[model samples]
Target chain A: MSELVPNKSIYEFYRLVEEHHILLAFQGMMTTDILTMMGKNLKEQAEDHIFHRRIFSVMVELVQNINLHSADKAYSESDKKMVGKGIIVLSTSADGKIFTVASGNLIRKSEIESLRQKIDHINRLSEEQLRDYYLEQLRAPEDQDSSGLIGVARRAKNPLAYDFIHVDEEHAFFLLTVPIHQQNSDK
Target chain B: MENFSIKGSNYIPTVHFDAKSGVLEISGESYHEYTVEFFQPIIQWLREYLATPGREIVFNFKMVYFNTSTSRRFLEIFDMLEDYQRSKKGKVTINWYYQNNDFDMLESGQDFAEDVNLPFNFYTF
Candidate 1:
């Protein structure tokens, strides 16, 4: 049993995390309870209330995006329900000036085009335009799903970065990165 | 209808909608996952309350944090109030409370105010 695991790989994983300035990382079932717990812990790591609120709001939106749309699913006995599986990584720039919330989850390959178009459309908007777009979508209809991404972009005040890596004929690994600058606290 | 009240958690807000006083208040942090589903009954209660001809309504939104998903529902409530006021059935007032330094929250209030025709009072604690 001892031979099944390698010490060198474990040490390397630790080094990788340290090098990335990762504050928190979790990969597993995405449930509301899990979100609440993670949010509480993450809030504890920041002293500035306004900054943490921004991070916390972004984290909630990103986690819900996974919970609502991830193609990967698993049954959790503790939760007594089926839940989405995804990864969330919170890291800071080396200078500690910007915090990045990175997330990944499995998504249907069919969704790639639509997702790309939605994100690209958001990335092209100016700040004022983004706000107007958000309000416009919010007023469109309750079923519209585009407002979440708009809200995220508006709050982050930065273009979202994304990548879709094909994993199989039917599924792809979707990665989204949103950077929150600490200076935005003044805004 | 009797007074509607639900205790808040770390993720859900405390909702107190008084049918008698016509003062509906939602306070605390709200980041619930099933946002639409969670707010349905509350919205229904409002619908029922607004059924009568004349009833003064004071809606207080004392939220510290709510996700973007919740924003749509908030807008729905504002729209309902706007409609109610426009119909000349009752007087409506909205008091939006935010923390002193939470400008994002304040801006959200301002945005909602600008979107609707109802009176909105902004307060900071």
Candidate 2:
């Protein structure tokens, strides 16, 4: 019989991430405090000022989406709060010319279609159009479900790549990736 | 009415609205879980103040960062100010202060300025 070694698998996973130049990665319950701390860390670590602001802004919205809309919730050490469970990863390209932020969380199957539609709509807009849409949404009445993904698209200045994997009858795993190109100093 | 002032927390902004001075200021970062709930009272106070607003009102915003939820609330406040201005009740001025190097914050101020019909004075620190 083959031996099942869990420790080796865990070690390999970490080794893979380290080799990829991952700046930060977290998988588990996400809270506002944790989000703030992560933002601070990223701000301090990012070499480019513009990239820091864009990434920090985009990360805040992404994590907030997970916190507010994730179907899966886990109890934190403090019983007073219920944290949302999700995964967020930030990594740099092998050439060190691009940074990508990726996140995934469980969402209700019923909401996946609409969410997909919103991302598609955002992906199709021009930068000017996206800015106009963002302003329009800002003026509109509050919709809790809307995380203002257009704002994310504007900051990223790139298409939002996303996918949905069916988890079960009622839930699906939603994954989103945003790529921010690092501008050369000469430009 | 009594003046309202709440010290800023890690996730919520500091709100200082002085009834006597007619100087309303919101500063710091805001990304509260229940954004609307936290700002509802402040909105109410603004409404009440506008009913019999003083001669001059200056609203200052010096926010380092805020989530989309908080941005919506800000639009609401701007809408209210516009309404007050349309009524010609008093002179309303908005001071949007941003860090000198923070272009995003400057753009946010410009966005708000475009949406509302008011004299939005932008200051860079």
Candidate No. with top TM-score: 1
lDDT of 1: 0.88
RMSD of each: 2.0, 3.1
Proportion of the native interface contacts kept in model 1:
0.72
Docking class of 2: acceptable
How many angstroms is residue A164 displaced in model 1 relative to the true structure, after the best TM-score fit? 1.2
DockQ by candidate, in order: 0.78, 0.47
Q: Write the per-residue lDDT of candidate 1 for residues B1-125, one digit (tens) a residue.
A: 88999999988999999888889999999988777888998899888888885789999999999988889899999998888888858899999999998988998898899888999999997
Chain A TM per candidate, in order of listing? 0.91, 0.87
| Total clashing pairs for each candidate | 0, 0
What lDDT score belongs to each candidate, Candidate 1 first?
0.88, 0.83
Clashing residue pairs for model 2:
none
